[model samples]
Target: MAESKIPIYGAIGANVAIAVTKFIVAGITGSSAMLSEGIHSAVDTFNGVLLLVGLHLSKRPATAEHPFGHGKELYFWSLIVAVLIFGLGGGVSFYEGIQHIRQPEPMRDPTWNYVVLAAAALFEGTSFLIALRQFRGQARGVPFWEALDRSKDPTTYTVLAEDSAALAGLAVAALGIYFSHALNMPMLDGVASVVIGVLLAGVAVLLIAQSRGLLIGEGVRPETAKAIRAVVMEQPSVEGVGRVLSMYVGPDEVLVVVDVDFKDDTPTGDAADAIAAIEKQVRARFPMIRRIFVEASDAPGGDASAARPGAAS
Candidate 1:
C-alpha cells in the first residue's frame, strides 16, 4: 500500500495539469462538459491530498489509550473524503449541469475542446495504469474480490475508484465535445457534465459505505480468520480452540483475543509455559497481528478467565 501511494500522488499531479487546462479550454469554448471535467479533476486533486493525510495518519504508532493502533483513522478520513465528494464535488457539478440543461449555451471553438479532452484522457489513463500496477503487487497472494472486500487502506481503493471515474468521465467529455462540434448544440455538453456528476456521486456513495464499515470496527475477513485459527491450532500440545476474536484497528494491524484448551492435565508452571509458547507462536505467525491477548481455558471444573474483559456480548 505504501508503494501504491506513488501512483495516487502521480494521478493527483496529473489532475492539476488537466484541471487547469480544462478550465482554460472550457472558458474559451464555453463548453459545459469541459467545465464539468475541470471540476471533476479539481476534486481529484483534493482527494489526493486527503489520501496522503489518511495514509500518514493511519500509520501512527499505537498509544496506551488506543492499543489497537491508529488504523481505524484511515476509514474515518476516507468517510470524510466521501462526504466531500458528495457535497462539494457531486452537488456542485449536479447544480451546474442542471443550469446548463435549463439554459443551454452554444459551444464556441469546439475544436479546441476535443483536443483538451483527448490530452486529459491520455494523462488520466496513464495515471490509472500506474495505480493498477501498484495495486497488482499488493493484491497478489490474495483473492481479487477479497483484496477489495477486506482492504482497510482507503487511499488505494479511493484512488482506484477516482481514477476509474476520471477515465470514464473523460470519455464522456470527448463524446459531448464531438456532438457539440458536429451538431452545433452546447446542451450536449451540459448533458455530459450531468453524466460525470452522476458518476462521481456513485463512487462517493461507495466510499461512504466502505468507510462506515471500518469506522464501526469490522471483524477480520473469513480467510484471515481461517489462517489465524490454523496457526493457533497447529501446536502439538493444544487440544482445541475455544474462540478466536479479531478486529481491524488499522490497515495492517489486528487486535486478537483467543481462548484455547490444553490437551491433558498440566502443572500451573507448565500451563504458564504453554501460554507463553502459544503467544510467541501466534506473534511469529502473524506479524500483522500487533496486539494479542491469550487466556488459558478453565480447568476441567473451573470457570474461564477473561482475555478481554467487558468485550461486547
Candidate 2:
C-alpha cells in the first residue's frame, strides 16, 4: 500500500502557524526561551517541506539506474533535514541560549508569553494527533522509541516527534517564564531557553539515527522475516527456504529476496516454474511486499555465505 502524504502536509501547516506566532511573541516579550522554541518550530516547518518533496519524488516508478524504485530517497532527504535541524536549528539555539544564560535579561510580560505558548501547544498537539492516526497500524506492535527506529515513514516520525517536542518545550518555557517573573530573576528565562534547545537537539539526533539506518538499508524485523519465510516454504516443489532477506523499500513496501532448495529429482524447468509460482504467491498474499526474487538450489538450505543478492537459478 502506498503511504499517504496528508498527515505530513497538515503538520507543515501547523508548524508554519506555530512558528509565526511563537516568533512574534518572543520578539514582543523578549523571552529567550520563547525565541528558542520559535526557532525549533521554524526548522520543523522547513523539515516538513523536505519530507513533502521526498515523498513526492519517492513515488516515481522504477528507472534503469534504480530498477528497485526511488523509495530510499525518502531516507536520504530526511537525513539531510535531520542534520539541518540538529546543526542549524538545535545547535544555534543551544549556543544562543547559553549566551543568554550568561547575561540574563529580566523576564517581562510573562502573561503574553504563556498565552502564546498555550496556543502553540494546541496547534502542535493537533498535528501530532493527525500523525498518530495515520501511523496506527504501522506502529502497533512496536514500542514508541523502537517504532521510530524501525519505521520507514520518515515524514510521519518527523511530524510526531516535532509536535511532541514542541509541546514539551512550550511547557518548559512557560515554567521558566513564570519563575523568572515571579521571583524577579532575569537568568531563569535564559535557562529555560537553554533547556528547550537541548531538548530539540536530542530529538534531532534521534531522527538522524533513525533515518541513517534506512539510508543504509536495514533488514526487516523478526516477525516480517518469519512471515516471508513461511510464505516461500509453502510452495510444493520447494523443499525449504534457505535464507530470506527483506528490506523496507518504501514506507509501506518491502523488497524480498529468498533462496530456496528444490527436490533432487526436480528438473531445471520444473524448478524454474516452482520459483515463479512462489514469487507470484508471495506477492499476491502480501501487499506490502512489492518485489520478490526466488532462486532454486539442490542443496538443502543453501550455504548462508553463498547467498547472492538477487534471484539465482
Candidate 3:
C-alpha cells in the first residue's frame, strides 16, 4: 500500500505545477484548449490529493463499527475522483468548448501555448513513466489491459490514466492551436477542447466502473481461486471442498470462507486439525488472505467432486 503513494505523489506535483502554468498561459493566449487543459490539470491535482486521503484513511485499524477496517474508503474516494473527472474536468471542458465555438475568438500567436505544451508533456511523460513502472511491477507478466482490469490498487492505475489523458490533451491542444492560427479557423481550438473532454469522460467512466465493482465486492482472480481450492483438496482427510467464497476487503486484504467435507468416518479432532492445516497452507500460499473461515459439513450428499474448482461466489 505504501508503494502506491510514489506515483500518486509524483502526479500531484506535476499537475499542480502544470495547472498553474496552463492557467497563466490560457489567460495570456485566450486559447480555449489551454483553458480546458488548465481545468484538467486542476482536477487531476485535486484527485491526487483525494486519493492520498483515501489511502491514509484506509490504513485505519478495524473497529467494532467496521470490522473490515476502512479499506473501502479508498474505493469510495476513488469513485468520487471519477465523478469529479466527469463533472469538473470533462463537463466543464465540453461547456467551454461549445461556448468558444459559438463565439469564436480571434487566433493569437501560439508561441506560449507551444512552449507550455512542450513543458507539460515533459512533466506528464515523466509522471506517466513512473506510474507505468509501478503498475508493471504489480502486473508482473500479465498483459497491460488485463493487468489493469485485475488490479485492486487504484492509485497507480488512476495516475497512469490521468497522465495518459494529459499527454493526449497536450497533443490535441497543440494541434488545435496550430491549425487555428495557420488556417484562420479559431473554432478548431474549441474542437480540441471537446475532444480532450471526451477522452477524460472515457477514462472517468472506466475508473468509475472499476471502483464501483471493488466497492461492491470483487473476488480474487480465477487462477488464484483455483490454486486455493487445490491447496484445500490436497488434505488427506478432506473428502471434498465445496463453494470457496471470497471477497477483497482491501487492496491487500481478502476474506475467504470455505465449505469443507471431511471423510465420513474422520474424528472431530482430526477434522479440526485438517482445517487448521488448510488455513495455514492457504495463508502461506496467499498472504493477502487476511481472514479465513472454514466450515466442516456433515450433511448427506455432500459430494463436491463435480463442482468446478474456484467457482466461488
Winner by TM-score: 3
Lowest lDDT block of 10, candidate 3: 304-313
User: What clash count goes with each model?
Assistant: 1, 0, 0
TM-score per candidate, in order?
0.88, 0.88, 0.93
Candidate 1: tens digits of C-alpha lDDT, residues 122-226: 898888888777776677778767777766777777888888898888888888778877898777877888888898899999999988887887777777677
Ranking by TM-score: 3, 1, 2
lDDT of 2 by residue, 98-193 (tens): 888898887667788878888888888888888888777678777777776666788788888877888888898889888988998878888887
Candidate 2 to truth, TM: 0.88
State how far residue 83 of model 1 sits from its true place (Å). 1.6
Ranking by lDDT: 3, 2, 1
TM-score of 1: 0.88
Which lDDT value does model 2 have at 123? 82
- TM-score of model 3 relative to the true fold? 0.93
What lDDT does candidate 1 reach at residue 177? Answer: 77
Residue pairs in collision within model 1? 71-250
